[model samples]
Target: MSGKMIDTRVTIDGTFGPFDCRLDPRLCYTKPWFPLAETRKVAARTQYLAYKHGNSSTETIHVIEGRTDGPDSVHLIEGVPGRNGTPAVAVRIRWKGARPTATLGEATADARREVTRKATARRKAARSGRTGAPRAVVVHIDWCGLGEDFDEAAFVVEPSADGLYPVGAPEWRWDFASWWCPACQDSQPWHEVTCPCGLSRPATPLGAAGWNAGCALHCLTPEATSVLVDLDGSARIVDVHAGDTRIDMDRHAEPFGQAEEILRTALAEAKPGELAATGWERAPGRLWGRRYQITFPASRP
Candidate 1:
């Protein structure tokens, strides 16, 4: 049994595989009359139980009822069911390398460790007077459009002591307002000459700074006629049916005058017809007004 190799086989239910045999002569028994079918069933059941109990490998040896028998008397069998009256073969199974199941204490300790980690994190956040996650600040700018036309910009930032959140720079500057860069669509301070994407700041009408830094002028008349003048010097006249009339006309009067003059001159020279004959496009959906592009005359120094 120590050095000699014995041919061994294992059967679980009906599955079969090669088995390595390790027999001890001290546990040998005398060969009794065992029904071949019953012996096979017992051996298979023993191997299955060893596996279900977490044994990685198992070996079943056929032996008779005896205290000390030589390895010759003990035989390693493979699916052989002898006759009913034949010498009964008792199976001796040895389970190898079984993994111990986890104890209740170990499982409880793991759960406790997880709870402690979460408690520590919550305590840290409480001490700092902040949640672990940063808050999202959504700046919804409605350019007088409804539903799908509403533009929304969101910023995820760490909350500051003051309720106001800083835009581009760490220190907020009141002199310049934040404007969106046309090239990259990133918000930048108004005083920035060039965007990070290398796009130069577009020119705006005089006095069109602060909140109106990147605003398009929507000039409305009492007759429901409106002209939309963009910062790029493009103008479009559209007939507006309904709109908000709470515009800060007094604050934007100077910029409106400059934008209106540019549009008036461009229309007169380009179309050369009555204002009504210029073909006002109907724009009922334009809550603010329709935006049109026009070229500004070169400034003569």
Candidate 2:
């Protein structure tokens, strides 16, 4: 496995029925498929046991991770990446029994979710809170109408909030929050908490993360990814610079993370209707799973 890929592989003896495997952290971190250090699994499953009928072994498979009541569900299990950048799996199973109407192509249609016998640790660890070092990022946008008027067209940005401005054209960002305020354009303090008028409820920008989780790596491609944080590790941000644009609504990031310390510091210094982007020159983007660059698009055209 490469350093920036999220994937898992399983091998099973047709007669044994279960496949057990564990991965090195360095390899597993590159994938969104992180599991517990140890896992017991069944690759292929079937309803009827052909061995009892003197034919031999029939394969059966069941997949379940993150428990029945968790938020993360297996969106899919494919043999490879689709036309778009989606998750995939390459599974090889053997079954010598019955006159089943199945082929490799047909098998794709039968993709099933697999379950792990010892999945308790994977479930809990994924939900646990972890803290890491503090990193900073800076976002610079050519904007106008940077304020909190709710109808100002956009919020002010930091680094240089000396002048009022609205962000790029509509559809540029689906939802977002600014480091500066529109009413009084100026750089905001490092720790001021911002409010988000997200899709449903009020999303609180505890710091810089966008409204949607996917936006965490706004400027990064998967090739440079390194880490993936749990849900509680980050907060949501809603940036409605114009209308409903994916580039606009998103989440902000901190280390594994630093919410309270950062939040407390920001709220203490920032005044009402104000904002600023920390550490000038770059916009934030996801790389290897965490936010690493502050001054984004260092190589933009």
Candidate 3:
């Protein structure tokens, strides 16, 4: 199944049969010099209609016309399979024209207003338990043609929160490259560590560690006082004691299944300063032995 658009005509090669339709003139508009200036006009003229085959047959279902204005361009037509499996389709026509520009003050004000509106809507949806529909996966096709000469490219479109999917186009917030913080629910960049709400980023493993280390310390008797193990396979360790640490086998030699055996042996036979004898370097944090938190690569492993 596939779809193509040439000027105002949209054609869909559906499962049951081919669908042909023309976009309403009101729903189509010239890309304006100032997008916001045309926002109200486009919003007022937006239309939606469903197309089906014979009256008795209920197999074919397609949204032939559903127009909406987006941040980048206007979505002229969007279609989704109804009951039977049909490929999702989107037709976006970007007219060749000069790019639009706006005054700094106008752009800033519009951005602020849009942010506030989206934030408010997200909060309301959270309270009402409405997360909207999940993004849809589809095949996107791009074509350029002049007379008989044309170039075409097609790629699979994976589901993402930032993209305008056929199923969730109406609800897409246009917050590209950003995510909702779990702590405050405010949208933040994916790379940001601390959110404006004063929440510190949670700990996550940087990458797979070559070596596995298990440390055990005993204050009295043979029983272990504190035992620490690197189970996450990350290169870093946090909130661990810096006493006699035992560097175990490389992760490849001994899988995590032997973690219990490794822990038992370290607690029973390992002693302090054994790590240094193996020529493994140690760089402890400010509170080294007391509240040890260090990140050192396991070069030998």
Candidate 4:
């Protein structure tokens, strides 16, 4: 499905960075002042959205109005810090047709507050075993435009799941990348891998997640393609494997297995090009204590 296309603008109050304030004769005969200003404004807005609502919430900036540029059109300006040698307060403006008058800062803040409020309420509802309301889940998805060659990544959180739990509760926390010990041919923790052959390997991306267990990047994954998983007998899942993706949630959020169950169901029903958030979970916390289940997408792919 197509995503929402909201208008946006960015502004930079100061003069600096690689931007040339003067008009450039290279791209076009038009003066560079207005174009440069618009560029800085767009940059600022993009950064602000990413910081406030994450990458998914950022809207596409339009240079020209595809529709009629009539009196009914309204413009919204967003202000952002001009870090990285840019303007002090870079502003981006969005021209939308028939919208209320509100500053981007005000709108963004209100939206963020609402998101937090809703997310908190959903979490509370889940904790209290309220089945009427849906459980929240967050996911990282690669969205492709209809005919576009590349994909855009979106990290999003939903307030509820379709059918909360026809699947099951989450009992494991799956890690996608771990280290593989060549000698043992088994997944080892990322920080350190000590093979029975007395061969010690360094940390690698495969097992990088193990660093939280007092494991260093080099000390984590010895082999480089494997990782340590929960013992099969411990959780509902037996073992986690490579190419398998797992859900990471807030330590204080998700009741442990609930998020996993929602993901399991969504994965079971998901079609190609269809990435669902299921709901938002927590951010990554400690690694060892967390249990993970192997994701179907990575497994099948």
Candidate 5:
């Protein structure tokens, strides 16, 4: 505030904008180059860094769209540009590492693939009349700790009554097979899947067993006892990430904790299931100790 105004330009995409990167002495003292306290102070300020910093340095115009997560996406831009005052810039921004999710394109693509795969499996199940919905793998959860390798240490996916029918075969494709849409939400084309919120449904094909491979996250279930969790749904689930991590095959992998959080949040916002859990107990381990049981929401005709 004491110094005379100095003109500086920050480039975004192809546009240049005003910026001030002059290291504030107060802020500079907290440089990582220094020790403990300094770094902590800097860290606190950095914890809320905006993408504008990157946009200023690298001259990249990154615009985020949508609500409920636009700002979060900008968190992807971290680190200073490798080259200063250069038309081009470089930064080892761990876009994925910055958050617990993939890019929009990545998430959508993965969802599309999952939906198709599930449709195929469902079609097969329907041929066999596998009326049996995905079973919930009951895991009594306990303490969760990140391994030294930072791998998932404790996790379990519990069946929930968020009642998000996975995207499935179009009604014309699956005969006599219909999914639940909230109480009376407008229905989509997919009969095997529907959204109670009337949001877009899962894109999984009808009768497909999309859960054959992934189980990345775990959701705590107080609904039913000794049940397996299904991965396909109309909402964001850790199961997709779980399967990506080979969680089901690797008993050592602990992803149940993340899955539980996902389910908890979803169920908390959703209507209570008609099938209430009856029993409760704990699992034997350093984690997954306290487990509960309740019934699942009924499926649509």
Candidate 6:
């Protein structure tokens, strides 16, 4: 299918003593089906799978009371009632683009928290005068958030402070800290560190950079994206604003050549705070030889 194909749906409903719903062999090595591992288990057992995909989309799927043997098809085997005690379950598979399902969303959120925890732990470990080297934290830069206004941000994963990482929205505020409840085997923010079962856990310091970068990214305007790059093998974003020329966030996805020219011109001639835009404009050449232009769009429009 072409890239324009945004949404597709598939339904699988059947029962058998034992059968295999084989899939593309290439995907075995690729992680295209990841993040949905848990959801696939639920969907497979419930005999229902609903997926949706788009630039920014949500998904809803049913989870039945069943568990998979492994993260892959190897775990889907089980015993059957009859047929010489052969496996009773059957596998059905389908592929879809990256659509956020409840399971996948939860996984992403958990990953985000783990990343924050690891980064924070590394920073804390460095400051605590610990003997061991800080945890190896590798930050990933991506354009996330919802809608066309998606901006660049970083994420990484590490162990939870109390060795417990829960699934849900992360608490990344400056004052948020993680506390573990032994009774529940889960973690919570400092405010609710006390479990309903009367188990109260002590708070652990969260790294300052976690909340600092989060808050900074959130406060940036939608029209302005945080430009992150991997230069010299290290991921970093240098926030250097041109005095007179502003980066056009709308055209952030344009070709590399166009973006390079804009950057070159802005650096060479743009005064502080100057605005720039990228679009098509007629050039002083053959009638059909118009070229792309960069200038401020009409303010009134």
Evaluated at residue 160, the lDDT of candidate 3 is: 25
TM-score of each: 0.16, 0.15, 0.18, 0.17, 0.16, 0.14
- Judged by lDDT, which candidate is best? 1
- lDDT tens per residue, model 3, 28-108: 121111122122222222211223332122211122111122122212122234454332223222222232111111123
lDDT scores for all predictions? 0.29, 0.25, 0.27, 0.28, 0.25, 0.26
TM-score of 2: 0.15
Q: What is residue 168's positional error in candidate 2, in angstroms?
A: 24
Q: If both were scored by lDDT, which would come out higher, candidate 1 or candidate 2?
A: 1
lDDT of 6 by residue, 81-169 (tens): 23333221122211122211111111243454454454554455457654532121111112123122222221222223322111111
| Candidate 3 accuracy as TM-score | 0.18
Which ranges of candidate 4 are over 4 A from the true structure?
1-131, 137-178, 182-301
Q: How far is candidate 5 from the true structure (C-alpha RMSD, Å)?
A: 27.4
Q: Give per-residue lDDT, candidate 4, residue 253.
A: 32
lDDT of the structure predicted as candidate 5: 0.25
Candidate 3 segments whose C-alpha is farther than 4 A from its true place: 1-107, 131-208, 212-301
- Give the 10-residue window scoring lowest on summed lDDT in candidate 3: 10-19
Query: Where does candidate 5 have its weakest 10-residue lDDT segment?
Result: 205-214
lDDT of 4 by residue, 1-301 (tens): 0122111111122111122222222311222232323343434444554457543334323221212221222222222223322111111222233321212222344554554554565455447653332111112122122124222322221111221111101211111223333434444432235645454543322121122221211132222222223422432222323334323323333322332333343333343533322121222447545444222111111
